[model samples]
Target: MKTVYGPYRSWRLGYALGVDPICRQPKVCNLKCVYCRLGCGGIMVTERGRFVDEDRVKEEAKEILDKEKVDVLEFRGTGEPFLAKNLHEIVRALRGLTDVPFGIVTNGTMLGRDDVRKELKDFDVIVVKLDAVDEDGFRRTNRPHHSITFERTLAAIRDTIAESKGDVIIQVMFYKGNVALADRISELVRDIGPSKVFLSTPQCPEIPGLSKKELTDLVELFSGMDVRTIYTECAKER
Candidate 1:
């Protein structure tokens, strides 16, 4: 079986269907987080642009929403949705197709760019990956593209949320060795003050060598904060 994925319920947004906008051509993303489903292939430093059948992707989203009456339309799968360059246009088109709320999942490395933030500001929900709180942890877990600096990536996230005022949900996926400092994460969230800060781990074997207890512990830590935890695997049981 092909893992029988979604339309599964999301923690913060709602139900989602792990859709890939790029459609698996050839491209690179900013992060190489160990728990990611893309394996080791999709990590790249930089690229100009790529082609995706935007019309088809929109059609599929429409069909899925029409059939299921889902709560949110989330764009995340094989690779980063923001990398598609034409993501804004795709989201704009998706708005016309359904009343469902729209969202995008990204590594937050590109959000600092003016064009990227501009395109994203109109979205209903924006989930950013913040696995590391500082440069060292950022390097250790993310294994980001060489073109991206940790400072630049972090700054972009802060600036994007400051200007957009959209539902900016920051996700921190905890790992054992490559763990980010909790103080740093707390401080960053305090400063950025996104709509929510979601702490979770690889519930499925999207990436290997992760443990359930570690994720549970991270959630406990974040419970002290004012953010909401979007527990996909953990919440399903409840």
Candidate 2:
């Protein structure tokens, strides 16, 4: 499987080159999020382990950097990235290959661990998922592993943002499942105080996304923060 892919026009990061540290088949993730584009079944585990070879990732990254230009090298693919134990090594090695900023799209489950937090600090941008504020909403929307609790996940995200040296961005996906908790989610995000907040609805065909008006209303709740909506970004791109 290809470890390095993309240079795709991302709504949040412009042209982003993707790095899949967990380049495994059937995916390997801790959360079975309802709106996940990767659909249902995958290897669900909370333990950290090396899934992809760091040297191979660096080699592929070097090949791509030498030939193409991208705004950021983002760690996000078929599954949760932090589960890959050698993520730090891959980031460190790839940094030497290009001057472009590094970023990661994570579910924030691993941020509680000191080692994971340390590795994340090396990234220029850390986009974290925080779709729900309470247990019911979290379970219904994210469907995290049995060991993960909403309280712990929320606290981890808060702690990570407070301590991170880089831009800690909160990416909240709004849908019918957790749309009612928008105010609560906004309150928590305000308390955590991330560098930026991304409000979006699922773009996957299987899940019905929110209407433009619904998203616009939700954006109004996060008044003081630096907020960006998927719809707004799409308009800008067009």
| CA lDDT of every candidate | 0.67, 0.87
TM per candidate: 0.84, 0.94
Q: After superposition on all CA atoms, what RMSD does each candidate show versus the true structure? A: 3.7, 2.2
- Candidate 1 lDDT (Cα, whole model)? 0.67
Flag clash pairs in model 2.
none
lDDT of 1 at 238: 12
Residue-level lDDT of model 2, residues 148-238, one tens digit each, is 9989888888888777788899999998888888888899899889999999898778888899899988988999899998887652221
Model 1 earns a TM-score of: 0.84
For candidate 1, lDDT tens digit of each residue in 1-238? 1111357776756666555666663435667777765566664645535446667667766666666766776777556667777776677777787776778778888777767767886577888888777777778788877778889988888777877767888887765554547656766776777777877666555454345555556655555455555443435411
